[model samples]
Each structure stands twice: as structure tokens, then as C-alpha cells.
Target chain A: MPKAPAGTLYRGREGMWSWVAHRITGVLVFFFLFAHVLDTALIRVSPTSYDKVIGTYKNPIVNVMEVGLVAAVVYHALNGIRIMLIDFWEKGPRYQKQMLYVELALFVILVVPDAYFSLEHTVRTIFGST
Target chain B: MTATVDGAGRPVIEAPRSRAPRPGRARARSNFELYAWVFMRVSGLALIVLVFGHLFIMNVLDGGVQRINWGFVAGRYASPFWRLWDLTMLLLAELHGTNGLRTVINDYAERPQSRFWLKMMLYTSAFLVVTLGTLVIFTFDPNISG
Candidate 1:
């Protein structure tokens, strides 16, 4: 196959990058859900086992990872809407780039507050309150 | 317009404009893929609500994960509303993720054998998760002593 030229409109632009981000975040969230369901299942074994496992989630490292997980879910959710619009709405294809910008703006708007709330206890645990 | 002469003086035949099968014809193809496409969008809208609600409650509210424990689990499960909410979320999220991974596998796994095995594994995991989760939700005994 012949090498394609660089800087194509669709190849390296917002559309392509958003698609890549959506797929990556989606897979991350899916795998996390698998583990999450299993962990929650531990409650059926015994409360002691459940609490012991869940307690590990409270530590600083996993707390940060929780924030990351939430971020991934948020991004995937927002972009999934964008994808629906691009499919269902008549003008959505024309304005996909604009929609992506809207999606990103909404992502930051939602995730920042979520991260703050999610990490507040961890932050307090790591560093004393003022 | 059915036929035109090419540069080589050979005739090019056009396919029938209406490719729909005639009445009484056996239709070999179904709208499975079309339904799958629509399912993704519909389930995605539902999951946005279910998943974000779950994230808000479990990860962002009232000291977040720090306060989650077996007692917290029991308290939430005590209510029928929360139990149904969790059950719906679990089923929808698992199915949505399974379909999404199926698409990814179809896209990337070029080898037929690899694709078949990957999808088999994906389906098995999905089945296990759905069954285990449903059982746990229904069979949870909050009063058990260990």
C-alpha cells in the first residue's frame, strides 16, 4: 500500500482524536466495571470480607485512581452523547467539531467539581486542614 | 440507462435501482446490525443517568469512598428503590460494555481465530458478571453474622 499524505482533515483532527479518546475511556471504564462488580459481590460472602476489600479503596493511591475512573466515565458519557447526535440529528455531522468543543467544555465543568468532592477526604488525610 | 459503453467498447451493466426483494422472496438478511446500532444509543442515554448517579453517590457524596463499607452497603440495600436502581444499572452497564467491546474486537482482531476466541472470552466474562451480580443483589443477607 502507498503511504498516505500527512495533515488530512479527518485523520489528525478533533474528530479523530475524540473518537480515539472515546474508545480508550470506554474500555477503561468497562474493565473497571468488571472489577467493581466483583468487589461488590464480596458483600455476599461476608460483611467482613466486603469491608476488608472496600477499605483498600479508601487509601490515598486508590482514591486518586477513583478520581481517574470518574474522569474516564464522565468523558465517555459526554462523548457518547456527541456520537448519538452525529448519528441521529440531521445537522450533527456538519457541526461535529463544534459539538466536540461543547462536549469538552461540559466534561471539564462536570469533572472538576467531581474530582474536588471525590478527593477532599483524601486530601485532608494526606495534608492537615488549614 | 441500464447499460453504457465503456472506453474498451464493452458494456457496463448497472445494478437494479430498487434492490428490495420481491414479495414471497426469502429474505436472508435481518436488521440485527441496525438494531444493535440503535441499542447503543438508547442504552447509552440510560447509562448516563444510571452510571453518573452511581458515581455521584459512591465517589463524590458524603465523604465519598471513605465512608463506604459493609454497613453502608446494607443500608443502601435495605431500600427496595436503591436495590432496583442498582440492579438496573448493573444489567444495563454490563450489556452496554459488552456490545462496545464486541465492536472493538471486530475492528481490531483481524485474524478470524483470534477474533472468535476474543469474542468468546468477552461473552463468557459478561455472562459471569451478570449472573454473579444478579445473584449477589438478590441473595444478599444483611443480617448475617460471621
Candidate 2:
């Protein structure tokens, strides 16, 4: 008989979710870094080109995506510290679930305010025109 | 080992289940993985401060993104302190994120060919971005007007 379909590893536990989120956020941050570098480099070609590229970022779509970027950075940073603890601290693996909870709680506290600030800016930028 | 012939006439050695090695400690290799792990932690800690400060200055302070123009970038790049700061952030973030994805690809891609190709692509892109970014940081000139 064929083996059963592979179950999702992320469904296992808090640790699994943390692992999944770390990878997801890592990719997100990587892509952002790529674009950021490319756009910032436009300054070498010409200031007009640089301004034009960055000017596009003021649009509502890019504004929303900025929030996603912030979320990814926040989660990755938190989980990165957790991973370090797990690697170095003898008791870290044992209390990983508790650590994950703390990470999540902190994620919420940090992200909510950041989201508010980002959305507030975006809204103000989009609708604040005379 | 029991030998069997398939329809394709290929011999297969069927080792008994009892011979399977149980998962336990990983065999030691070079200290590369250890160093990579430590780099991720150290770079990540530094990135938290560098990245957030960058975001705050660019997007929150003063007039925010609206204030970012050619002149602003030119002025910032003129300062050696900001130049060094940005260069460090660029290198640390690129290396840390690249290593993180390397771990992800290793875990998810079971096929050897897939793993090799994916890593090749990842590394190439990482290299290109780092090179281009570094060049931009050091070579940027404010006097080059359109």
C-alpha cells in the first residue's frame, strides 16, 4: 500500500508554527531587502530615477504592503532570539512552548502599534491631500 | 541482505528493518553549521536595532517618506557614519536571511537535484544583491543630477 500522505509539520505544535513563521518571515524580509537595495541603487543612475521609484511607494498598495513587511520583520526578530536561546540554553527546549507564547504575546503588542502607525500614515498620506 | 530482481532486471538489496539506524545525535562535521547558527543570532540581534532605526528615521521622523528625495539620500550618503551604518546593515541582513532560507530549503527539498539547484539560485541572487548594494552604498554621488 502507498504510504499515507505527509501531514503538515506546521500542524504539530507551537514550536512548529514558530518554525513555519520564521521561514515565511525570512523569505518576506529577503524579498523586501532585494527590492530595497535595487531601488536605493537607482540613486547612482540619477536622482530623478531614484525619486520616481520611491515616489511610487506612496501609493496605497505599497502602503499596505509596508505593514506586511513590518509584521514579517517583527516575527522574524522575535523567533530568531527564541532560536538562539534554544540552541544555547540548556532549559530552553523544555520551556519552548512557554517561550513561544511569550513571543506571540510580544508580537501582538509590537505589531498592533506598528500596524496602527503604518495605517495611520498611509491613510493620512492617501486622504490627507488638500 | 536479500537480493531481488525487478522487472527492469535491476538488483535490489532489501536490508531488514532491524538494521535501520535510529535517529539520534547528528554526526559531527566542520563547524560551519555552528558558526552559521551563531551568525544568525548575532546578526539578527543587531538587525533589530539597525533596521528599526532605519525605518523610524525614514518613515516616521520629520515629514516621513515624503521627505525622502535625491537630496536627502545624497546628504545621508555623504556622512561616513551613515554610510558605514547602512553598509553593515546591508551585509548582516543579507547574510542572515540567506542562511535562514538555506535551512528552509534543506528541510523542505528532499530531492538532491532540487536542493542543489535551489541553493544555487539562492546563493546567486544573494551574491548579486550584496554586490550591487555595496557598490551603491560606496559609489553613490549626490552631484549626478538629471
Interface RMSD of each: 2.0, 2.9
Error of 2 at A92 (Å): 2.4
Candidate 1 residues lying further than 4 Å off, grouped into runs, are A1-10, B1-27
What lDDT does model 2 reach? Answer: 0.84
lDDT of 1: 0.90
**Candidate 2: misplaced stretches above 4 Å?**
A1-11, A125-130, B1-28
lDDT of 1 by residue, A37-124 (tens): 9999999989889999998899889888888898899999999999989988999999999999999899899989998998898788
Clash list (residue pairs), candidate 1: none
lDDT of each: 0.90, 0.84
Q: After superposition, how far is residue B114 of candidate 1 from its true place, in Å?
A: 0.2
Q: For every model shown, what is its TM-score relative to the native structure?
A: 0.86, 0.82
User: Taking the tens digit of each residue's C-alpha lDDT, what string does model 2 give over B10-124?
Assistant: 9887666774555663564589998997788889899999998887787656756657888998888889999999999999999988998898888778788999999999999
Q: TM-score winner among the candidates?
A: 1
TM-score of the first chain in candidate 1 relative to the native first chain: 0.90
- State how far residue B42 of model 2 sits from its true place (Å): 1.4
